[model samples]
Target: MHNEGKTKMIPFGDLSREYDDLSIEIDNTVAGLLKSGWFVLGKKVEEFEEVFADFIGKEVFAVGVGSGTEALHLALVASGVTHGDYVITVPNTAVPTVSAISFSGATPLFVDIDPDTYNIDTNKLRELVVIEKKRRGNKLKALIPVHLYGQSADMEPVLAIAREFNLTVIEDACQAHGAEYKGKRVGSFGDYACFSFYPSKNLGAYGDGGMITTKTPEQAHTLKMLRNYGQEKRYYHTIKGFNSRLDELQAAILLTKIKYLDTWNTRRRDIADFYNQNIKNKAITKPVEVSYGKHVFHLYVIRHPERDRLQAYLQNNDVQTVIHYPLSIHLQEAYKDLGYSQGDFPVAEKVAEEILSLPIFPQLRDKEAETVAELINSFS
Candidate 1:
């Protein structure tokens, strides 16, 4: 759809546009917060937490944290996962997922992902749980099923497997804000669900922020204490905790943005639909939406054998793209101490090599999306 004489450079994400769209509301909210003179863990933070908890599900309680990693880490700690415990997760996710487990003083274990869904394969998870139980009985403390790319990781089987093995379930929903499974939202399934509001997330904040959703009031209280130097009241420490409280400014910004999350997500899906219908290249594989749930399409990723070549061609043609992950966590140098080999997670490694994330955001023009697809279609 771009002019032949002039190539248009489509960015992978444009946070500035998102800000511009919400500038008046955001500026007003920020100005009001500045006038209040209270910055950390104030009224705005409590309001956002309450609203977010209600959004996730009935009876869900949300605790705002400093970052998504801290959300996962605190959730694990609150669940009693500690040193010498092994936590299971897929290897194909962002490093923060693994980092959270490690920060809890628990060993991180891996299972391969389903090729189609790019989620933790339930079959592989079950088999690995059985094997782990036999080898290290009662040491497997938790299961962190990452809802990668805004689709729930088939929660039915995942929850069943956790119950069978007595493992606590933590949903890493950093990329899935309004995503649902079988009509129920993602954050409701696990014992605790973690979300990130980094600048580019589907429901992003102006800066780093995170949330943890839980069903138990006791756990919610514990999380509140843990995020603020273990204080049940002012300067009263009950247990050792960290300085991971969500600030008031970010919380105010999120409050303004939260009202528009569903709209933005719908626009993202529209862009994905346009890409799916228009990209006619047979060599490129489009993203598949599972039958059981709604995918917010946080990242509209595609696959091809000639991934590197295709990326270069797109780049040369002024169409920007990026790999969701170029390397699986198991293969990363920092995680080598986990004792995983090169071939440990074959599916994840293979998919990592082939996956490429195209631009999909609320503000992206339909013509821009069509242009991206056209560019990909023309790639040999």
Candidate 2:
């Protein structure tokens, strides 16, 4: 599939191009922050928190933290997930989601994902909750419904089941910035919603950062203290906490980038639409966007039975691709003690082998997208 002339290489993600596109504003924002002198947990962080909270939903409070993992850890602690309790989440998600649950000293339990959306299967979640409640009793403390790949999980039933089982809901919305379910943003549906601002995320910062959104003022206050070494005052340490503050520099950068989130997300959606319509190979399964909400296309993933062969073919043709998660968390060696085996989560295990992420960033050009599609179609 090599071209007569060298084909241009398409990158899976190009943050450098995004920075180049917004270099002026980003430069000015970082410059202003450098001159301000106050860096950690300063006014810039406060401003970004408020702006992000407003973006998620009215009356929601956002707390800036060091990384998305910290956001989830703090949110779990604030919501009372503790040692010996079991927190449930999909096994197909990135390890950080499970790591956050483990960080709270709670054991992680597995659920399968929806074959279409790659989010938690709500029916399986309900069945697990019922069985776990009767067996583990109230020790089954929380549920982290991950909004994987920029689409919200079926939150109505997720929340309803949470209430029925008396389990706290913490949304793993690290990939779902600005994503919505039934007209409401993802962060609003959970007791606490965690987000990551890793450089590649939908709402990425220049470096590592994260946020937790909550509707409760008390929870917000607790999170603020938790992120800043448990300090309620200048020298007062009230509760056990961690050092995980989002610095002013990243906060300022995020503030600049936040202004363009919608536009950038729209461009991402447009690219996904192009891929969806053009990649007509019967062997490929285009991502499904459920009718219940908007998917912001954080990662334009597709599936094929011979996923590895397809990825290698695209690479050989000067196109880039990646597997979202080549290994499901339960199968990873880090969680071997969790007692999960190969067939424990059939859908997640099967999807793990087949999912492939194509080039998809707001900065990616239509020509590059078309080239990617052509390469995929040409793959035998």
Models 1 onward score TM values of: 0.98, 0.98
Tell me the TM-score of model 1.
0.98
lDDT of 1 by residue, 1-380 (tens): 65788766899999999888888999999999999999998899999999998888877999999999999999999999999999999999999999999999999999999999899999999999999999989999899999999989999999999998899999999999999999999999999999999989999888899999999999999999999999999988998999898999999999999999999999989988899899999999999999998999999989999899999998888888989899999989999898999888999999999999999999998888888988888887
Q: Residues 251-314, candidate 2, lDDT per residue (tens digit)?
A: 9999889999999899999999999999989999999999999999989889999999898888
Cand. 2 TM to true fold: 0.98
Judge candidate 1 against the unseen true structure and give its global Cα lDDT, from 0 to 1: 0.93
Error of 2 at 49 (Å): 0.6
Best by lDDT: 1
After superposition, candidate 2 runs with Cα above 4 Å error? 1-5
List lDDT for all candidates, in order.
Answer: 0.93, 0.92
Name the lDDT value of residue 81 in candidate 2: 88
Pairs clashing within candidate 2: none
